[model samples]
Target: MTEKQREEAEWESINVLLTTHGLKPLCLVKRTDLKDLIIFDKQSSQRMRQNLTTLVEETSRQQSMIQELIETNQQLKKELQLEKCRVVDQEQRANDLEQILESVKSKVSELEDESLNRVCQQQNKIKDLQKEHTALQAKCQYYKKKRLEQEETIAFLQKDIYRLKKEEEERIVTQNRVFSYLCKRVPHTVLDRQLLCLIDYYESKIRKLHKQRYD
Candidate 1:
């Protein structure tokens, strides 16, 4: 074939191929421009493929990081649950201690009240005892005074009785001697009268001494 016919046949084939592929036919463009365009399209396609590969790698790395974050969150949740349980246990212990403290305080208060009551009772008893002691002391003093007075009176009475006894003895001896003399020298009637008078006087003195001793 001739070169012009060959060129015309190739143009018609390109137009037919463009029409079948749903593209517009080339209009008065040179072969050199078509070659340059093909080369630019190939370079652009290569760059797009390289960018797609880099984007795919970055997406895979992001997915891996997300998976690690999920695992870490699960572990954190478990730890938080354990911490909550520990906090609850500590709170219970604190409550129990508070109750024990209250009980101790109540017991101390009761003991204090009991001790105060005992002290008051003891003080009252002491006061009563002191009053009784004072009264007893007064009675003892009165009794002591009475005893001393009685002792003095008893001593005085003993002395008087002794003197009276001595006087009576002497008087009795003198009367007996005189009566014997009268019996020998005087008459019976005169001796009897004198003896009677002396007897009456002696009886009166004895009565007076008895009255003084008793009083």
Candidate 2:
């Protein structure tokens, strides 16, 4: 049964016992017997008072236990809230990490594109240099052939000068006439122009080759 119902039944049983016993003065033949009865009634009333006090104390203890239980429940609820907050914070951190990862991925993609473009430019520059090197090789060959022809011409001019000197000496010509005739016959201007042209051509070729090599 409920606590209230059980308590009420106990009270009723106690009242019925007290009623059956009847609170009456005892009649006896001696004053000592009457005093003994008084003492017995007083002891019974004292015992009842002690029992009521004990019951009040037990009730107070139960109230204290209930209050403590309520406080503990409140503390537990606070802890649960804190745990929930921690969970939410962790979730937010995870989202932030995801966003950061996405940003890094985007930056990596951009760098990859830029790197590819740079590689293409470098390849094109290399191709152009290769073509320039081939052209320079052809030009060097042409200039080498021309230089050989110029050397042969120079040798022929020297031989002609030697023959002219021998003829002049054999004929015993005047030095002034010989010098004037040699000056008139020699193509000094043409030789100077050819030498200067070759110098210019080689200089140009060297500069172009250097540019292509560096490029």
Candidate 3:
């Protein structure tokens, strides 16, 4: 809203023209020789008035259009700022996802290493168990050999016992036969003491013979 001011000379000239012919001057014509060319004719005055009015209307319209353009530009600036904030948020989310992915990969590597270690330990334990099993088998075989030896000894002792029993029975039968022969064949005129002494001597000789046979 800037106000336009005219000089005193130009104001006086416009006043003079209006009083002389009843015509309002819009502008003084720009000519080298004519510094104050005022339009006082009725037709020219009316035409100038119409042109000035049209110019005023066109200026008002242009001012309104300029104000609208200024408002739209401000709104565009606000939208651009919001878009920038959104882009920043999205970038932060992407960074977080990348960190999570790296952490998962690290944990997976640790788990894999643990699994391999466990597998190695299990293999060693299995090897130790196999060695223990082999040792147990050998010990079992040794015990079996000792058991067989004991069995053989027991059989030998049983055979020796049977032989001694048979020999004892044969000696008893021979003693009975000798005693019956002595009772039947002894002389009736021999003295009882002499006969008893002869029986004792024969028993001693039989014992000697039996001992020699054993030797």
Candidate 4:
């Protein structure tokens, strides 16, 4: 039963006992019976005082528990605000990373186009060199020299292609790192840890509040 209900029941029980035992002035009682009634009334008063003290103590404890719950709720709200700020910052970073990635992609496309143009130009030069080497061979005097120059030109074009490939690979690796960093769900920061701790603390406080309410 609720405290109020229990208190009401106790008061009703006390009134019923007094009436049943003829302790009221309206009813006559023997002297011995009157003394017993007095003692019983005194003991009942003492018991009621003890009950009042316990009720006051319980009420004080509940008030403290409620105040603590309010403080904890406020703390949790502050932590939620911090979490929201962190999320906004992370979104901004992700947007910045996307912009950077787009810039890198544009650069890569430009480089690829330039490399293809260079390859076409080199192929045309190789064709011209071959024709000149044939002409030199027909002249029979500088054939060996023309052949050596054509080989060197071919080697240089190969080196340029290899260098471009390596550069493209490095760009890909950098883009992957940026993507991974942006896609991570949680930010790695003291603020995140502090927010998490605050949430846990408030959650525990809520549980304690529930326990106190039930108790």
lDDT of 2 by residue, 72-163 (tens): 99999999999999999999999999999999999999999999999999999999999999999999999999999999999998999998
Regions of candidate 4 where Cα sits further than 4 Å from its true position: 1-40, 141-215
lDDT of 3 at 151: 86
Instruction: TM-score each candidate.
Output: 0.55, 0.48, 0.48, 0.46
TM-score of 4: 0.46
Which is better, 2 or 4, measured by lDDT? Answer: 4
lDDT tens digits by residue: candidate 3, 1-215: 11122343565675576556544544434344543343345655675677567557767888888888888888888888888888898899889989999999999999999999999999999999999999989998988898898888888888888877775665545444555576664344546446555656676688789999999
| Candidates ranked by lDDT | 1, 3, 4, 2
Go through the candidates in order and give the clash count of each: 0, 0, 0, 0
For candidate 4, write residues 37-109 as lDDT tens digits.
Answer: 3233555656556656755776799899999999999999999999999999999999999999999999999
What is the C-alpha lDDT profile of model 1 across 1-215, one tens digit per residue? Answer: 75654665676696577567554444432355353232224544554465556557767888888888889888889999989999999999999999999999999999999999999999999999999999999999999999999999999999989988987776665555566665654325875767846865766688789989999
List the RMSD of every prediction in angstroms: 13.4, 17.8, 11.3, 53.3
- Measure candidate 2: CA RMSD: 17.8
In terms of TM-score, the best-performing candidate is 1
Error of 1 at 166 (Å): 2.7
Question: Model 3 clash pairs?
Answer: none
